[model samples]
Target: MGALLNQTCYLCSNTKNSIVFVENGIDIVRCSNCGHVFSTYEQEEHYEGYWDDDSSYDLGWWDHAHREIYQDFIKRFLTAPSGKILDVGCGLGFLLSEFKIKNPVGKPRVTKYPKKRFNLPGIKTD
Candidate 1:
């Protein structure tokens, strides 16, 4: 039996009926009650590999999408006169770059994974 078969549902924390979803050699189980989905331990390796692949890390396509969303978020969330804004989980620093360009008068800081440096110019990492 797979690990999911013995585990409780992730949504409602119930130990009752659950549904399994399998795609691209990955397996995830969902709770029927609250509709929460979780992957089994065996699927973690495959999921990590999929994300860690260099091709997956390519940010060209993601940059365009993120830029639009980031702009909208900034317009909606930022209302202070002038303050420091720190962005976390900033993949490739594209959002930070956009924020800086849009808000030249405000202070915007970006935080990223130490090993994953963005290819954009003028992004400083240590």
Candidate 2:
């Protein structure tokens, strides 16, 4: 278990909070006032962890695991037939690829690797 964060609740501005659980070395907290679940770890504004690595990173399991979730998300929210989609940190562009397949009229753009954006394995930007 991790220590309680001194910061106030982001939603209701209440200072009272309790630790929900710790996952992957970060403490997940819940606000006592608004019931909002958030992480206690302070993340960098522009944290370039794995996204900055130029080496070939294969996340085949991630694509396979998130396919159904991405499909459901596109069906639920991305209902627009034509629009601009700006995806930041699109690891392997799985979601964008799914979006493109469902809605081919939209201009889907990834912000991670500009030079290699169109070179993702399963993504086809036509």
Candidate 3:
């Protein structure tokens, strides 16, 4: 178990004003400083080798219903898709895949801080 970094809220950086929303099963803490909710506590050794494989994520992210929802967001927010689309924390590349289908010419750029787990390079968006 990796030591859970639960000292302060990521947004407001306040340690004194936290309330544990769940105390028994898993400590889900909500920071009063910024009203940000976070899950507290993780295994001290966070890295469980091989278990974090991309295929493992694929199974969980198989809910294709999100494609419609993401399409709705694209229709509402993005304009023409001329520039590179930046997808922050692009988990499993579902949204990016949709974007690629919508914009064939524009490049899709994905980013994840610290380390990126997976990259859906050359996605067959069509």
TM-score against truth, every candidate: 0.35, 0.35, 0.41
Per-residue lDDT tens digits of candidate 3, residues 47-120? 34433434444443453668779878888777675635655352655676565433221112222211233343
Per-prediction CA RMSD (Å): 10.7, 9.7, 9.5
**Model 2: CA > 4 A from native:** 1-56, 83-92, 101-126
Kindly indicate the candidate among 1 and 3 with the higher TM-score.
Answer: 3
**lDDT tens digits by residue: candidate 2, 1-126:** 765444566446677778888887677888888897877775444454545556587667888899999888777776787644646343666676665433222113333443254444433332
lDDT value, candidate 2, whole model: 0.59
Evaluate model 3: give its lDDT: 0.51
> How many collisions per candidate?
0, 0, 7
> lDDT of each model, Cα atoms only?
0.50, 0.59, 0.51
User: How well does model 1 score by local distance difference test?
Assistant: 0.50
| Model 3 residue pairs with clashes | 1-43, 1-44, 1-45, 2-43, 2-44, 2-45, 3-44
Candidate 3's C-alpha runs over 4 A off are 1-5, 44-47, 50-69, 77-90, 96-126
TM-score of 2: 0.35
